[model samples]
Target: MSLRMATDADVPAIAALMRASVRAIFPRFYDAEQTAGAEIHIAHLDRAMVDDGTYYVHEDGGEVVACGGWSRRARLYTGSGDRDDDARLLDPATEPARVRAMFVRGDHTRRGLGRAILEASERAAGAEGFTRLVLMATLPGVPLYTAFGFAEVRRVDVTLPDGIVLAGVEMERPVTAGRTRCPPGRP
Candidate 1:
């Protein structure tokens, strides 16, 4: 498999992959109702992420299998079906870079794809002088972020368009000189 920065042309494939991945993987942690309820709100690909060059996609056999990225912008996650001040530039001196939109193909789980993207984002953000990284972790993404040294700061209840609220965790980890320590055996 190969990992590369995502381009605008990759958005459609990325969105499909995100939806497939979430539908297949989230059921393990969420019920069918909750899974279906939150799918649309959770699976969209924000074109701005690609435009900013902070998003990435993993390819295997010429197929995009996993996708994710980080951002200097203020948006923590996309497709929440709400309006917020997500376009503001973060103060890297005081705020952590936002580690947004991460997903892997369900059949491709347990491999290092997610870890690879996470590390790439951390390195990219660190290169931009961001000393820390933060993201809103879906129930299924918690283990991956935690394995990457992110600690849960709080639980956030996201209300979807139809009023179905899904639980998420806000997580953060410090970045030091373009390096981070992943938990042993996580990848």
Candidate 2:
């Protein structure tokens, strides 16, 4: 697989992959309604991430198999409602870089695609002097984030536009220099 920065032309395909990943994986952890809500609210592309050049796509045979990225902006995640300061720059020393939308094709999972994205994100954020990374993870993504050294801060419920509440976990991890893999027995 080839990993590279995402361009505007890749938005539509990345979005489709995200929705498909959610539909295939969320059912195991969420109810039908929640899954649908996540597909609508969580499975989306953040154009700001694209514009900022923070998003990435992993392709195999020239097809996008995985996608994700980190953000230095104040916005934590998509579907969280717009804020006046969403576009504000983060202070890397005091604010953790946001690990935004992450998804993998159902047929291409467990091949380390998610980990690869996280590693790329961590490296990029670390290079920018971010001391930590944070994300609001859908239920289906918690295990992957946890295995990547992220610790859960709390459980949260994000209400979609239609008032459907989608449960998620708020997770964070320190940006340890040169740390590629989680240490044995560490959560």
Candidate 3:
């Protein structure tokens, strides 16, 4: 379908798509509690797309089928990438944008929506004067990000507030440096 900036009207469908995406994608790398925790967490984090100012969505027939976002983050932030290289290798003056919270609805899988969201996010980052963009990828999402030229910086097992553990890969792509110049799969 068609990608666009997320608006207030798409919020509910975006939330449902986020939950379904996490519930479906996280299971390949985690267990029942972890999956449930992540699903619940997805439903809880509404403001991520709010004041953050860079939320985006792909809508079809007025329904949000995909969503993702990027925000200005401190280079020292640890949630989105491999800690060893990402945290240690980053300088706030250098990499100013981090892409987070990407979700594609379950029914829309394998349709290149993931790739589209990523490229769009990268373009947004570049437009914002950010050269490097970082993201945290669930196990299944790792390959998709990898295929888009995001190099792994680290892997982490994060414990939620409820003590449920979920693992993800941290990756970085240099969108403005001409290093991350891959094309989307297809429309």
Candidate 4:
């Protein structure tokens, strides 16, 4: 497997990977209603992440198995279906860089792909002079984030288009230029 920066050409495969990953993994943490709502709300590949050059994809045999990225933008996460004007530049001096969309193919879980992406994101964000990172993590993603040194700040209820609320966690972690690190395995 190899890791590389994402591009517009990778969007279609990225979207399919996102949908498959979410569908297979979310059901473990979410109810049927919540999973259906989240399927519509969370499974999208934001082109801005690629444009910002912060997104990455892990490919094996020319197929994308995992993808994720960080952002220096205003939006914590994308709104359902429609892409909005949420790409406002962030002030790294005052705001934590956003660790945006993160998803791995179901078969690729527990193989350290998520950790690799998270580390790459932290390093990129730190290189931009950001000392902190924050993300709205899906319930199934909490364990990974927590193990990576992120602290839960609060519980978030994401209201979906169909009036179903999906639960998420607001997590943050301080990341210095060379201080962000995590031990391997499901700790």
* The best candidate in terms of TM-score: 2
What's the residue-level lDDT of 47 in candidate 3? 51
- Candidate 3, residue 10: the lDDT equals 72
lDDT string, candidate 4, 23-75, tens digits? 99999999988887777778877787898899999998999999998999888
Model 3 whole-model lDDT (C-alpha atoms): 0.69
State the lDDT of candidate 3 residue by residue for 1-187, as single tens digits: 7887777777778778878887877777778887788777543333544455667888878778888777665433323233344323234357657776778887788898878877777776777677787876667778788878788999887666666667777788777543346646733
Clashing pairs in 1: none
Off by over 4 Å in 3: 42-48, 75-92, 177-180, 183-187
> What residue runs in model 1 are displaced by over 4 Å at the alpha carbon?
184-187
Who wins the lDDT comparison? 2
TM-score of each model, paired residue for residue: 0.94, 0.95, 0.80, 0.92
Give the alpha-carbon lDDT of every model: 0.87, 0.91, 0.69, 0.87
Candidate 3 TM-score over all chains jointly: 0.80
Q: Which window of 10 residues has the lowest lDDT sum in candidate 1?
A: 76-85
* lDDT preference between candidates 1 and 3, better one: 1
TM-score-wise, the better of 1 and 4 is: 1
1-116: candidate 1 lDDT, tens digit per residue: 99999987788889899889989999998888788875777888878889899999999998999999899998888656645778888999999999988999999988989989
lDDT digits (tens) for residues 5-105 of candidate 2? 99999998999999999899889988999888888888989899999989999999989989999999998988757789989999998999999999999
